[model samples]
Target: MAEFRCRACGQEGTWVYDPERYTCPACGSIDVHFVVFRHELPDDDPAAKRMDELATEEANKRPKKESED
Candidate 1:
Protein backbone atom coordinates (compact mmCIF):
# COMPACT_ATOMS: atom_id res chain seq x y z
CA MET A 1 0.00 0.00 0.00
CA ALA A 2 1.09 3.55 -0.68
CA GLU A 3 0.41 6.61 1.43
CA PHE A 4 -1.86 9.19 -0.18
CA ARG A 5 -3.41 12.57 0.49
CA CYS A 6 -6.01 14.31 -1.60
CA ARG A 7 -4.92 17.77 -2.59
CA ALA A 8 -8.47 18.98 -3.01
CA CYS A 9 -9.95 17.88 0.33
CA GLY A 10 -6.76 17.31 2.34
CA GLN A 11 -7.76 13.72 3.05
CA GLU A 12 -4.74 11.57 3.91
CA GLY A 13 -4.51 7.76 4.05
CA THR A 14 -2.98 4.62 2.66
CA TRP A 15 -4.19 3.21 -0.65
CA VAL A 16 -4.08 -0.31 -1.98
CA TYR A 17 -2.26 -1.35 -5.14
CA ASP A 18 -2.75 0.88 -8.15
CA PRO A 19 -6.18 0.48 -9.70
CA GLU A 20 -7.90 1.97 -12.74
CA ARG A 21 -9.18 4.71 -10.44
CA TYR A 22 -7.04 6.20 -7.66
CA THR A 23 -9.58 8.28 -5.87
CA CYS A 24 -10.01 9.73 -2.41
CA PRO A 25 -12.25 7.69 -0.12
CA ALA A 26 -13.39 10.81 1.69
CA CYS A 27 -14.51 12.93 -1.29
CA GLY A 28 -13.88 10.77 -4.37
CA SER A 29 -11.57 13.44 -5.67
CA ILE A 30 -8.80 12.52 -8.14
CA ASP A 31 -6.26 14.79 -6.48
CA VAL A 32 -4.86 11.89 -4.45
CA HIS A 33 -1.09 11.53 -4.45
CA PHE A 34 1.56 9.45 -2.74
CA VAL A 35 2.95 11.01 0.43
CA VAL A 36 6.46 9.90 -0.48
CA PHE A 37 6.63 12.31 -3.37
CA ARG A 38 5.26 15.19 -1.35
CA HIS A 39 8.62 16.85 -1.70
CA GLU A 40 7.81 17.29 -5.34
CA LEU A 41 4.71 19.29 -4.60
CA PRO A 42 4.59 22.95 -5.65
CA ASP A 43 6.90 25.32 -3.77
CA ASP A 44 3.95 27.00 -2.16
CA ASP A 45 2.66 23.73 -0.69
CA PRO A 46 3.17 23.30 3.05
CA ALA A 47 4.50 19.81 2.74
CA ALA A 48 6.90 20.79 0.00
CA LYS A 49 8.10 23.72 2.09
CA ARG A 50 8.75 21.47 5.07
CA MET A 51 10.72 19.06 2.92
CA ASP A 52 12.87 21.95 1.75
CA GLU A 53 13.58 22.97 5.32
CA LEU A 54 14.55 19.44 6.30
CA ALA A 55 16.81 19.15 3.28
CA THR A 56 18.51 22.38 4.20
CA GLU A 57 19.05 21.17 7.74
CA GLU A 58 20.63 17.97 6.53
CA ALA A 59 22.87 19.76 4.09
CA ASN A 60 24.01 22.18 6.78
CA LYS A 61 24.81 19.32 9.13
CA ARG A 62 27.22 17.71 6.71
CA PRO A 63 29.92 18.64 4.22
CA LYS A 64 28.56 19.59 0.84
CA LYS A 65 28.22 16.48 -1.29
CA GLU A 66 28.75 16.33 -4.99
CA SER A 67 25.71 16.96 -7.13
CA GLU A 68 23.78 13.86 -8.15
CA ASP A 69 23.80 15.14 -11.70
Candidate 2:
Protein backbone atom coordinates (compact mmCIF):
# COMPACT_ATOMS: atom_id res chain seq x y z
CA MET A 1 0.00 0.00 0.00
CA ALA A 2 1.07 3.58 -0.63
CA GLU A 3 0.71 6.52 1.76
CA PHE A 4 -0.91 9.77 0.67
CA ARG A 5 -1.53 13.25 2.02
CA CYS A 6 -4.69 15.21 1.42
CA ARG A 7 -3.91 18.64 0.10
CA ALA A 8 -7.08 19.91 1.70
CA CYS A 9 -6.55 18.95 5.33
CA GLY A 10 -2.93 17.81 5.29
CA GLN A 11 -4.13 14.50 6.68
CA GLU A 12 -2.11 11.42 5.76
CA GLY A 13 -3.39 7.97 4.82
CA THR A 14 -2.58 4.74 3.05
CA TRP A 15 -4.10 3.48 -0.21
CA VAL A 16 -4.00 0.17 -1.98
CA TYR A 17 -3.93 2.08 -5.24
CA ASP A 18 -3.23 5.58 -6.50
CA PRO A 19 -5.42 8.17 -4.75
CA GLU A 20 -4.95 10.92 -7.29
CA ARG A 21 -8.68 11.18 -7.95
CA TYR A 22 -9.75 10.36 -4.41
CA THR A 23 -11.37 13.01 -2.23
CA CYS A 24 -9.97 14.20 1.08
CA PRO A 25 -11.90 13.15 4.14
CA ALA A 26 -11.20 16.09 6.42
CA CYS A 27 -12.01 18.87 3.95
CA GLY A 28 -13.74 17.06 1.07
CA SER A 29 -11.10 17.97 -1.48
CA ILE A 30 -9.89 15.79 -4.38
CA ASP A 31 -6.39 17.16 -4.12
CA VAL A 32 -4.92 14.03 -2.54
CA HIS A 33 -1.35 13.10 -3.40
CA PHE A 34 0.80 9.99 -2.86
CA VAL A 35 3.58 10.25 -0.28
CA VAL A 36 5.60 7.04 0.25
CA PHE A 37 5.52 3.34 1.20
CA ARG A 38 7.03 0.51 3.28
CA HIS A 39 9.37 -1.86 1.48
CA GLU A 40 10.74 -3.96 4.36
CA LEU A 41 9.47 -5.29 7.65
CA PRO A 42 12.35 -3.86 9.65
CA ASP A 43 11.68 -0.54 8.02
CA ASP A 44 8.10 -0.50 9.23
CA ASP A 45 7.38 3.07 10.20
CA PRO A 46 4.97 3.83 13.02
CA ALA A 47 3.74 7.05 11.43
CA ALA A 48 2.60 5.20 8.33
CA LYS A 49 0.68 2.68 10.39
CA ARG A 50 -0.82 5.45 12.48
CA MET A 51 -1.97 7.24 9.36
CA ASP A 52 -3.56 4.07 8.04
CA GLU A 53 -5.34 3.44 11.30
CA LEU A 54 -6.50 7.02 11.58
CA ALA A 55 -7.76 6.96 8.02
CA THR A 56 -9.78 3.81 8.61
CA GLU A 57 -11.10 5.12 11.88
CA GLU A 58 -12.04 8.46 10.41
CA ALA A 59 -13.65 6.84 7.41
CA ASN A 60 -15.79 4.72 9.69
CA LYS A 61 -16.76 7.70 11.82
CA ARG A 62 -17.95 9.94 8.98
CA PRO A 63 -20.30 9.70 6.03
CA LYS A 64 -18.67 9.26 2.66
CA LYS A 65 -17.92 12.75 1.45
CA GLU A 66 -18.87 13.30 -2.16
CA SER A 67 -16.35 14.51 -4.69
CA GLU A 68 -16.56 18.14 -5.61
CA ASP A 69 -17.72 18.90 -9.14
Candidate 3:
Protein backbone atom coordinates (compact mmCIF):
# COMPACT_ATOMS: atom_id res chain seq x y z
CA MET A 1 0.00 0.00 0.00
CA ALA A 2 3.05 2.25 -0.16
CA GLU A 3 3.43 2.54 -3.89
CA PHE A 4 4.06 6.26 -4.02
CA ARG A 5 5.99 8.87 -5.94
CA CYS A 6 7.73 12.04 -4.79
CA ARG A 7 7.04 15.06 -6.93
CA ALA A 8 9.67 17.01 -5.03
CA CYS A 9 12.54 14.67 -5.75
CA GLY A 10 11.16 12.09 -8.12
CA GLN A 11 11.89 9.33 -5.63
CA GLU A 12 9.70 6.32 -6.29
CA GLY A 13 9.63 3.06 -4.36
CA THR A 14 7.74 1.12 -1.72
CA TRP A 15 10.16 2.13 1.01
CA VAL A 16 9.88 5.82 0.17
CA TYR A 17 6.29 5.84 1.33
CA ASP A 18 5.51 7.68 4.54
CA PRO A 19 2.44 6.55 6.42
CA GLU A 20 2.23 9.47 8.84
CA ARG A 21 1.33 12.13 6.27
CA TYR A 22 2.25 10.51 2.98
CA THR A 23 5.36 12.62 2.79
CA CYS A 24 8.45 11.70 0.89
CA PRO A 25 11.05 9.92 2.97
CA ALA A 26 13.80 11.01 0.64
CA CYS A 27 12.82 14.66 0.34
CA GLY A 28 10.37 15.12 3.22
CA SER A 29 7.94 16.72 0.80
CA ILE A 30 4.21 16.26 1.11
CA ASP A 31 3.86 16.59 -2.63
CA VAL A 32 3.71 12.84 -2.88
CA HIS A 33 0.85 10.80 -4.26
CA PHE A 34 0.05 7.15 -4.68
CA VAL A 35 0.21 5.58 -8.09
CA VAL A 36 -1.33 2.41 -9.41
CA PHE A 37 0.43 -0.63 -7.98
CA ARG A 38 1.69 -3.05 -10.56
CA HIS A 39 2.20 -6.65 -9.61
CA GLU A 40 3.73 -7.55 -12.93
CA LEU A 41 4.57 -5.79 -16.16
CA PRO A 42 6.07 -6.80 -19.47
CA ASP A 43 9.85 -6.75 -19.84
CA ASP A 44 9.54 -3.82 -22.23
CA ASP A 45 7.25 -1.80 -20.01
CA PRO A 46 8.80 1.62 -19.56
CA ALA A 47 7.12 2.13 -16.23
CA ALA A 48 8.57 -1.08 -14.87
CA LYS A 49 12.02 -0.15 -16.05
CA ARG A 50 11.76 3.29 -14.48
CA MET A 51 10.64 1.80 -11.20
CA ASP A 52 13.55 -0.60 -11.19
CA GLU A 53 15.97 2.20 -11.88
CA LEU A 54 14.61 4.32 -9.07
CA ALA A 55 14.71 1.37 -6.66
CA THR A 56 18.32 0.71 -7.51
CA GLU A 57 19.23 4.36 -7.01
CA GLU A 58 17.49 4.46 -3.65
CA ALA A 59 19.22 1.27 -2.59
CA ASN A 60 22.60 2.71 -3.48
CA LYS A 61 21.97 5.82 -1.38
CA ARG A 62 21.80 3.78 1.83
CA PRO A 63 24.86 3.27 3.94
CA LYS A 64 26.55 -0.06 3.42
CA LYS A 65 26.80 -2.47 6.30
CA GLU A 66 29.60 -4.97 6.49
CA SER A 67 27.23 -7.55 7.95
CA GLU A 68 23.64 -7.37 9.06
CA ASP A 69 23.40 -10.82 10.57
User: How does each model score on lDDT?
Assistant: 0.70, 0.63, 0.68
lDDT of 2 by residue, 1-69 (tens): 667788778898775643233565456687877654434212245655776778789989998768857
Off by over 4 Å in 2: 18-21, 25-28, 35-69
Instruction: For residues 6-40, write the lDDT of model 1, one tens digit per residue.
Output: 89999787765343445776788887776446533
lDDT of 3 at 32: 83
Error of 1 at 16 (Å): 12
Error of 2 at 11 (Å): 1.0
Which candidate has the top score in lDDT? Answer: 1
Candidate 1 all-Cα RMSD: 10.0
Each candidate's number of clashing pairs is 0, 0, 0
Ranking by TM-score: 1, 3, 2
Ranking by lDDT: 1, 3, 2
- Which candidate model has the greater lDDT, 1 or 2? 1
lDDT of 3 by residue, 3-51 (tens): 7689899988776322245577678798987763444455456666888
**Cα RMSD for predicted model 2:** 13.5
Poorly placed runs, candidate 3 (over 4 Å): 1-34, 67-69
Return the TM-score for each candidate structure. 0.41, 0.33, 0.40
